[model samples]
Target chain A: MIRKIFVIFAIAGLIMMLLPLVVNFEYKDSLNELSSQYVRGSIDDLKSQNVVTSVIVSYRGLDTLGEVTVLFLATAGVGFLLKHKKNKNSLRKASELLQTSSSFLVALIILFGIYIFVHGHLTPGGGFQGGVIIASAFLLMILSDINLKFNHLILHLVESFSGAFYVVVGLIGLLLGIGFLNINIVPLGNFGQLFSAGAIPIVYSLIGLKVGAELTAILNTMGGEQ
Target chain B: MTLTIIIILGVIMIAAAFGAIYFNKLLAAIVSAGVISLLASVIYLVLGSPDVAMTEATIGSGLTTIIFLFALNKVRKENKK
Candidate 1:
């Protein structure tokens, strides 16, 4: 009836939409000219083993900084909306096994988060991914323990300092005639080494700290702990 | 083989999307949505973007699920009050 007709039409529409993808299956293993140039230049320009990190933290630093600001604004908006008026403890206490295991895992999770961001320039992970991992660890901690409190002061300090320092580094690059947010200000160490990728690692680490703190603060505020 | 895997994952994603929409319980729906996000991460991994896959898995599934649960709890509390 009408339902069957609707389903038929929906399927037809979906098939029509996806027809182009199947018909135009031209997947290229090699980069296009522009991307090939970027790939070749990145080694000499940024000296980062991970071209993705070089693009994200160094080439597109300002854009990433803007994204971070948007996140900061979003977290601030949430805090304003969900700010607790009365400190009424509402969360039920989790079980003993959950509590003990969560506490034990928190440190390990934090360590992993740090590792992901610290090696961002040399690995597939980066600041945003690592920051979310750290925030998830805090989320787990929040779930297991009802009475646990976060040090908001430390979170704020980390957020502000990292953001400011990111800008400061960019400004320094601008002053040094390396263009804004360029990694040329710092010497590109031997490639593939942890110390390589001038300014990329430092920027990503700062970004990781800032993002981790911002997300943790948002979670705390949403959970009515702030 | 890869095409078959992609087709299977796509089916699962569609099924999860339907479950998220049709489930009566809010918690069930949220969990279903998380499953959809996780399946998407797997697809991203298969498509040769491990970094995007990791981000989608961690943020889209992990943190978003918790946030939705918190919001659901708040809504339930307010409804009860």
Candidate 2:
């Protein structure tokens, strides 16, 4: 009873502490100086239509690299922890409806994932979202067929090469004295076009591939494969 | 109209969060958590951040739920043995 009372008091105290901030909060009418600069830089300098993408893949590319590294560590940790032998005998067949629909839907889902990352410069969706979408397609496949074998070699190669190439692209910018991960190495074609944004699309695509492979490897490991 | 929608979503998300904490079955709790993420993604879209909404929907709702289900399944199998 005392514990419950204490919990209630704690909750009340927390609410009281936060209430003033909530009450005093006012929405800003326009972007602040930093954000307005980012918006302008994204449009004029980066030639990217999506301000968020430029901020993520161009201005703050190193932070995104760190994020990808964190994801890689996670994938490695999951892989290390869940090293189980494949038990092919205990698998049950999926429903006929699932079997048929997943086969047809998987291709379209993967295509959509590709589209998302490819258009990351122009669209709201980017490498992480696209990669997760692709991984979901693999998850669907694993759900429909437990005995299905994913070639681990191919997954690892994709993961490693894409990560290496991401760094190499950044190095190219460094070699050109344009700063690391600068997207101005290649021509920033035309604004609002797929080919625009110079190395942003390329770097984002690499991120997409690496993330997709790492996630698929994680799912494959969790699906009872070593 | 937008305020009403946001209010409704907020209420539902709170209810789902409570359900997640209170549910006895692990699967039900996992589903409840997914529901919270899905609702949050909708709220993000309503708040004019489609990028955040996509990430929340795909990773938070979709893959996290699947990973949890996989963990649950593995645990259940271990218990049976």
Task: Identify the leading candidate in terms of TM-score.
Answer: 2
Per-model TM against the reference: 0.91, 0.95
Task: For each candidate, report its DockQ versus the true two-chain complex.
Answer: 0.75, 0.89
* Displacement of the residue B80 alpha carbon in candidate 2, Å: 0.6
Model 2 per-residue lDDT tens digits across residues A41-103: 999999999889999999899999999999999999988888756553565788999989999
- Off-target runs (Cα >4 Å) in candidate 2 are A1-10, A86-89
Clashes of 1: 0
Tell me what TM-score chain A of model 2 achieves.
Answer: 0.94
Model 1: how far is A4 from its true place, Å?
16
Tens digits of lDDT, candidate 2, B1-81: 789999999999999999999999999999999999999999999999999999999999998998899899888877876
Worst 10 residues of 2 chain A by lDDT: A83-92
Candidate 2 residue pairs in clash (backbone atoms < 3 Å): none
What is candidate 1's lDDT per residue for A54-133, written digit by digit as tens? 77887677899899999999989988888765657666789999898998999999999999999998888989999998
Candidate 1, DockQ score (0 to 1): 0.75
Tell me the deviation in Å of residue B5 in model 2.
0.6
